[model samples]
Target: MRRLLILFAAAVAAPVLAADPAPEIRRAPVPPQALGVAHTLRTIPEACARLQGEFSGDAAAPYRFAVVRTSPGCRPRARLVDAAQARPSPASGWILNDLIRVPSAACATQQAVVRVWRQPAQVAPPALDPQGRARVYLEDSLQQARAGRLAPLPAYAVSLQVEGLPCPR
Candidate 1:
């Protein structure tokens, strides 16, 4: 009788002890519009190459890479701006121009910046959502454009320390 009670208690407590396990956080790709580009980087050198290709220069310009949270979901956004005020918004799942990691080292920090530009009536600006889902739209074609009619503005960002390349100075 005592053995049966001990077994029952053990069984009951086992499941209870296992309950409330740590929450699993799933990681997804960052959106393009938020970062001005859609590319995912493993290193800062790769990011520099991307930046040079996009802006035609290796020097650092105004840019940002970040993950934004919204009411419905989360997304990444990247953007790049030039000295001529030329801004290009990245498409969904597009490659980023900046790398976030150093050789065999993780990124120290990652951030995203939002830039707004005023265009003429006929001039088309990069698309943006009023509720801030531009990252989603830019990252995923299916998610393009939020409920509002306003197009999302172009944003540029960078991911660091991705595939073991050294981070940019």
Candidate 2:
């Protein structure tokens, strides 16, 4: 009886001991280079043209800034302004976290009024700061694209609505 009880206890304890600990979430600060890149992208003709095309058809279409590392050539400029970890206003559970640049015309000067939103849950908070989270999301998007998961937006994304400036006519 003693042997059986010990074995049972050990078995129960083993599972508990072996269980993996939850991953620690941390917020990483936005790198200064990211801001520099955003500024560079605004001046790049190729990037401006791409933005023009992206918003031409549907100005309100869901979109996120293309990661600079992944798209070295031409991509929209986006910067994380708010982290999902912060408490959202009571009016909405979603937080406007990103601002993407929209060109007034192909290769013309740009304006950043496009707002991107993500729920607290979507960001998997505490692990990364707003910019860090955005980077991860952009990287994941690249992977998904390579795998042929051609969805317009990541499922976790809440909204990519244009707030101020509309795409130039």
- Please report, in order, the local distance difference test score of every candidate based on alpha carbons: 0.31, 0.36
Residue 6, candidate 2: how far off, in angstroms? 80
Error of 2 at 81 (Å): 20
Residue 159 of candidate 1: its Cα lDDT?
Answer: 28
TM-score for each of the candidates: 0.18, 0.23
Question: What is the alpha-carbon lDDT for the whole of candidate 2?
Answer: 0.36
Q: Report the number of backbone clashes for model 1.
A: 52
User: With candidate 2 superimposed using the best TM-score fit, by how many Å does residue 82's alpha carbon deviate from the native?
Assistant: 20
lDDT of 1 by residue, 1-169 (tens): 5466445645654563354222122234333222233433322221122321111112254233333222233232323334134432333322233222111112222222222222212326446788754443454544443534544434433322121112355
